[model samples]
Target: MGNEETPESRERTDRTGWRGLLVDVTPLRTSPSFAKLWTGTSVAQIGAQITIVAVGLHVYDLTGSTLAVAFVALWALGPMILAGFVGGALADMFDRRTVALVTATVAWLSIGTMTLIAFLNVTQTWPYYVLAAINAASATILGATRGAILPRLLPTQLLPAAAALSGITMGLAITVGPAVAGVLVATVGFPWTYLLDAVLFAGAFLGILSLPPMTPEGGSASPGFSSVVESMRFLRNAPNVRATFIFDLIAMIFGTPRVVFPAAGALILGGGPVTVGVLTASFAAGALLSSLVSGPLGRVRRQGRAVTLAIAVFGLFTALFGVVLLVTGMMVGSAGPEGVNVPAVVLAGIALAGTGAADNVSAVFRTTILQAAAPDDVRGRMQGLFYVVVAGGPRIGDLLAGAVATAIALWAPALIGGLIIVALMLVLLRIARGFQHYDAFMPTP
Candidate 1:
């Protein structure tokens, strides 16, 4: 205890024995404010998921096309990317708490508007696109700001633990939200479901309001085009950070299989909206279980290796999902009442849950890298860039999955994407020994 112990070193020592795997994070979970933020975010996220399912269901009902449902995400991607970068930069220039509060208010208002439109029987596709895009864009901004704010609230060593906790929140939101949404949409109708989200969004506002004013780590930079360019230059010089972003982009771009969900729900799995909910929730369920048992993650020192390995595992699980789907297709033969089977759906859900768990582990490490390594003054801009990569990459994956599924089969995209991810990660790991050996105890410049 008297020795010169850094956070990373202490964490490593805490994991030295078999019992190290059971290292308690309770001692590190001291920040009441962070706990409050976590709680608020968790609640709001559940509501958000409910709205997402409702919106997709509403769009598909109106248009009767999988592409139309996919377009809702595609329309939002560009604006969301731009807003994330701008929001991140603004977070560096102003009070993060205030920024979050204002943006969250806008988000809630957008949802309220959507609810009104739905209630009025305006079931047109355009309104859904417009409102969904606005909501997505606002969410992008909120995500970046929130990412930047976390490092300020917790100790560096606790970052992994915090990430695990955040994963739990995400897991809970996704698991509960979509499942509940499926029930509500099937029973209560769409307007009430969207309205409920608007109400629950107030929880997010409360969380942001409770946070202390946190200015940029360094003095505020002027908000302008030049500032953004300067941040880009900073990122160019930071090879480790660049590598982390690229790796995450590759994983998301290749690994995300969300677009195939509706097709799987209606045809392959045959449970309709309920199957979609279950499939989606399966991923969150896996993530939630992983985070609940993630005491071992807090002690890992080679974070870069951990991230790479976790992402690779995610790809493997994703591939497994594709294989499971293929097997289900083989068993069912076609989309019909007799083809509707429970065991096949359950197997696919299990595979998806595994993928979600692995992805959450990767997210924790990637987030830790961004929070710990990036300079405070430039954190917002970097976060914004990170947001763009994270958000943008998945959309690209959606497009790819949709195209491939339409062309060949729904199962082909996952099989090909997973293989590509494994190959890409292996190549990246070999080339960048620096990333693999990155020590959390010794932060890179």
Candidate 2:
């Protein structure tokens, strides 16, 4: 029989024109399973983002403290880190589908509980913290499992395209979720906004339930501390993958200044929740746009250099964003929503958009390296560690940003952090010369 049409075949045939400039949809069209999974994940993440923003706004509303708002991410840090390691092990040892389904169930239930708490008008912050931690833990597990499953759904050549597509999923979710959350909290209140998340989360069940059993390839170690240790040992030997993690940790821990947004809105830039939403959506919009034009990314041979350049750009824009905030802060001291400065807000938004685009490009390359370089049996564990950096780094940044803002000025964290990222990445480029020259045609970890 003649060969049937497939994504790989199409990829071999097409290399130029507008089709190459846009995100490759071949992965979605090639695998009905991946399409379902992508759709479900997109819907669920959007809901998750909505709750994330709503919770921050709610905490700020209740306490009028940015530090308290930062505590939301702070509270989840320990649990999320633990979950990432354990969840990675679970994915490696058991059927990945099962691990994902269980974690998604926990996340959905946690959202449900959060909704009930909001509806009851619980003023106590402790309960919210508890639920948020649980949800974060579950989400980390789900993310690890999902990341491990991607390679199974498509050929190695499509991994970059798939990674770009995932960026779009995240970009869309982040863009829409925060914007909607801000509006919903203003109009319908916190309870309804949370309820919407709980409802939208059911889409995850659709994706997870449809997935076939996916046991790790070439067999995996038993699930336990030893398995986690094995993954760590593997990471120690993998220089290229290690560089990806370190670079991401630097970017997220230092450069992520999201914890300052609530206060920036109330005291510096004004526009309240709307300003917070716009600032966040702007970042995601950049990611979405980058993903749309990511067709050329799949062609680049020097992926490691690409990642480094993208992150350097990320740091540049982050510092510029800080400058905007600093100038705007000088113009308006303790300004309320009525005193919103349109020009400053627009400039800040533009800077944030640049950061988002740069970060998304970095993420696409980082994810490609991790997924492509690692062995299947260990991929889940690698992904788990990746999620720890991806998710936990932000939590660390939240605490750092909150502490620095409390100690100094609102703009200090981003400005200082962005500068640190640039300097450290430059140092990394010198030390990790091997990683800098890593070729996509022959991936090594």
Candidate 3:
């Protein structure tokens, strides 16, 4: 315990709270492979964001229906789930490096195909749907592979820090990526933005190539029904891991308010799409700031307790955002095209930022728990489930928010959903003894 404060730890923290907030950079310095992996994903994610937004813009440009643009996610959802399970099984069976490399190559090729479609100036909706689905499937695989890859790169004690670092990576990608994408699509057009994604995707290959061979210690299981059953059985006994997934789902499904942003921008806030972008990015911006100052998180002994509180805070902020919208809507009617409630917009953004910060804190602990507690052989499958929960939860959220918004007011759904999240999370934590008492220092799944 006396020798635990290494030079790297000293770099981020002191007795003072301000000094203790910086993210630890030890993972980057100690593990070059992890560093490469982190850097590669960070660079490529910016380009990925560009292509994602560009494709949506291209679709809306071709057909002026916002509903058609929503098809992008719907088409991809099926393939994304299939790939997650297959990818996890394959990762446990083969060398992790090889699995990542192959999946990354597929993802790269999908982007390359998009570039070709852009160059051809194809306006067909079917082709766009197909390519977007392919890209999503490949990305799902890549995420599971990377989740399994991280624990091997760093020691258990540093898993929390590594998760924080990854949070920072995600925060940056989500914060800056789409904003840049919006500008690029408006100025340079769509093809170049897609090409940038194709070029940047090669960075993932560099990271995969740098890793030492990582063969699973536990015996391999081939991808099929049997593998799925086996993994499911393992999870059935892994109460803590299951609790993590449930907690995340409750947070995302009830707290996510992304679907209402457009309504808020148009009807309530009045600033139009620009306002929508600002509000959307505000959440990620807070996440970025929180991750940068997450050095103190590693010291927390009861990570489950931390996650519980953070998620509750997230719910509270989400409710606050809804209140901002509700009050703004009352103060003024719909302001037609390009209208804005300046003060309300600012306050709404602050609430969203707070939600983002709390959510990121929960994410760091949840991710650390999965990586540290799960065994090497089963880690891939656990990670795959994690990806599914994480990726799928928001889509469910979108539908919930959208449907509820339709029935009631734009702000009412989020307000109701947030309250539901707070109540549900508290109930789950109180009932689930394993989750509430989960210790970071001696992790179990």
Every model: Cα RMSD to truth: 3.6, 3.5, 2.6
Question: In model 3, how large is the Cα lDDT of residue 156?
Answer: 73
Off by over 4 Å in 2: 1-9, 56-70, 116-126, 186-191, 262-274, 326-339, 402-412
Model 3 Cα lDDT, one tens digit per residue, 23-138: 87777876788899999988888778877888898899999998899899889888888888888888788899999998888889889998998889998888988999998888
Tell me how many clashing residue pairs each candidate has.
0, 0, 3
Score candidate 3 by TM-score against the native.
0.95
User: What lDDT does candidate 2 reach at residue 41?
Assistant: 92
The superposed Cα distance between candidate 2 and the true structure at residue 430, in angstroms, equals: 3.4
Encode model 2's per-residue lDDT on 367-417: one tens digit a residue.
Answer: 988988888899999999998887777877888998998999889988888
Q: What C-alpha lDDT values do all the predictions have?
A: 0.82, 0.87, 0.85
Which runs of model 3 end up more than 4 angstroms from their true locations?
1-17, 333-338
RMSD of candidate 2 to the truth, in angstroms, is: 3.5
Which has the better TM-score: candidate 2, or candidate 3? 3
Per-candidate TM equals 0.88, 0.88, 0.95
Question: What is the lDDT for 280 in model 1?
Answer: 80
**After aligning candidate 3 to the native by TM-score, how far in Å is the CA of 181 from where it should be?**
1.7
